[model samples]
Target: MNPELLIAFLASTAGAATPLIMASMGELVTERSGVLNLGIEGMMLVGAVVGFAVTLGTGQITLGLLAAMLAGLGMALIFAFLVLTLQTNQVATGLALTLFGIGLSAFLGRGLVGQTVDPLPHLHFPLLSDIPFVGPLLFRFDSMVYASLLLVAAIAWMLARSRLGLMIRAVGESPDSAHAIGFHVIGLRYGTVMFGGAMAGLGGAYLSLALTPMWVEGMTAGRGWIALAQVVFATWKPRGVMLGAYLFGGVTVLQFHGQGFGLAVPSEFLSMLPYLATIVVLVIICRNPQTILLNKPMSLGQNFRAD
Candidate 1:
């Protein structure tokens, strides 16, 4: 590959991976706190529609991003209430949330279809973007891309070193013991789950406002599922999530560019490549149960009631 083309491909790969990094990191934290909220796809869809609609109506990208996060947070609150307060099944509520988000976003975005807004602007440093190759690869990207990287770093630090991190880990490992030992298990779980939802919404906002800048029903296109798989593939490690997201992001970009490179494969097959890679990764990971058991939260997906 030409050096210039290779640089562009890498840049595109980073852009493609940004949303997954943010969303999966959020889920990683949520699961660490022992809550399995599987409604990421729904959250992303609702966020995309809400973000696009708000941006279109007000012409303010900031407002659009805020609205997207709020929308996702609201959906997560619903999930938290059902699973935590009402003691409903976590898996069922999460699946229902995804269905609800799909329908609601579709309805909300009906009129906004085909409309386009300004995509998120790339941050160009003065001398940095002027540099030969390093500038384009590292210095020129939307703020969110850098933000996602920082988010990953922050989460990793918090989970590994902070007192709060230890508390969260304790809660996830043994909620009953955590509850007995002066921890507000329900409260912490609610906080983590809500955070996850906001991140998912933010990821969706990145899709509509940055990646494509338009509202399409289900634009998320199962990236949410891929994000979930990322959490598992990373074995619940924050740094691992970052790497897994980039790996998938690279695959996604490759699929789009494969035909142009004369791979001679059907476009449909190319489109399916990202998903196929996801299944393959999941299958390989599942084959090694020990890897999962080592880091997975013990109380994940369980309903907790305050005694």
Candidate 2:
């Protein structure tokens, strides 16, 4: 293969992986706080439709992105109310949320079929993007790619250095202990969950508004579920999530290339690469529950009672 072709391949892999990276990182935060949100798929779907619809109406990609975040946060708040306030089963509530999001998006997006929007424009740095093989591979990408990198760096800084990050970790490890230390456990959980939802929503929006630039039912496929698996694959670490996202992204990009290379594989099987990679990574990580338990939020799926 040509060197330029390899660079392009890697670039496509990163582009494909960006959404997963965003969604998985968000879920990592949520799970770190001891909340397992299974409705991620639903949240992403809602964000996709809502973001695309808003962009179509307003012709502002920024507004569309904001709308997508808000939509996702709205859905997350509903989950928070049910599981946190009403004390419902976390898993069941999450599944219900996913169902609700899917139904709502399908109903609302009927008119958006076959429509298109101007996706975010790619940013090319002077001289940097013009470099021979590395330019196309590294420098030419939309703002979302940079945002994903920034998110990873920001998350690492927060978790490793920031006071608020410590508090979040405390909340996840043991809400009771965190409460004793005067941390607003409920507030922290709610905030993190909402943030996670927004990220997931942005990830979804990236697909509809940026990647494909069109609306389709079940467009997210199982990316949300894959994102959930990524949290586990990362062992609840921010950098781990980034690596896992790229790994999955590579699988995604390779599937398309596999067909081009005429590997004689079924398209369905090729498409399963990302999900299959997710499962394999999950199994490997879960093999050491003790290590996972150490980093996992102590109260992560347990409801808190003010008593």
Candidate 3:
């Protein structure tokens, strides 16, 4: 591979992986508090459409990103109320949320289809950006890309060292015990759920506002599910999520780049590459029960009532 090609591939990988890292990181924290949210895909779609609409209306990507987060937060609130307050089945509620989000985004985006906006500008380091491989690889991305990396570092630090992190883990491990210790398990879960929604929304915003600067139905292309699988593949570890997201991102970029490099595989197969890889990773994870059991939140997917 040419050095230039290698650099370009790595750069694109970072761009592709940004949304996954941000969304999964939020989900990681939410899961750490023992709440299972299947609504990320829905939330992401909501964010994408809302973000695109707002940006198109205001001509400000910043405002669009903010609206996207707010839109996702709104969706999370609904989920939290159903699952956390009314005690709905977490799995069913999550699935329903995904469906709702798909429909809502499609409906909302109907007017904006085929519209385009100027893509966000990449950040440039005057002196450092010109340096060989490191410069292009590290310095050329937009603010959101760099922010996602920082978010990963920040999340890792918080989970590993912060008192809040310990409390969240305790809730996930044993909610009853955490409650007996006077912790507000339900409240914490709500907060994390909202956070995850916001991050997922931000990821969706990245897709429409930065990558393509256009609105299209189902543009997320089920990346939300990929993010969920990422959390599982990473076994709830922050760094693992980053690695898995980028690995999958590479697979995503590969199919598009593959034929260009003389890979004779058909276009249809290339498009299926990422999802197929997701299934394989999931199978590998299921095959190693210990890997999951050891790291998975003890009370994951279970609801608790204080009555």
lDDT of each: 0.92, 0.89, 0.92
Candidate 1 versus truth, CA RMSD in Å, comes to 1.0
Instruction: Write candidate 3's Cα lDDT for 83-175 as tens digits.
Output: 999999999999999999999999999999999988878999998999999999988999998898889999999988999999999999999
Name model 2 segments beyond 4 Å from true: none
Badly placed stretches (over 4 Å) of model 1 are none
**lDDT of prediction 3:** 0.92
Task: Show pairs that collide, candidate 1.
Answer: none
lDDT of candidate 1 over 1-307, digit per residue (tens): 5687678778988999999998999899999999998899999999999999999999999999999999999999999999989999988999999999999999999899999999999999999888999999999999999999999999999999999999999999999999998999999999999999999999999999999999988899999999999999999998989998888888888777775555788878878888999899889988888977889999988777776
Q: Which whole-number lDDT from 0 to 100 does residue 152 have in model 1?
A: 92
> For every model shown, what is its TM-score relative to the native structure?
0.98, 0.97, 0.98
Model 2, 66-104: lDDT tens digits are 999999999999999888888899999999999999999
Q: Model 3 segments beyond 4 Å from truth?
A: none
lDDT of residue 155 for candidate 2 = 89
User: Looking at model 3, which ten-residue stretch has the lowest summed lDDT?
Assistant: 254-263
Best by lDDT: 1
TM-score, candidate number 3: 0.98
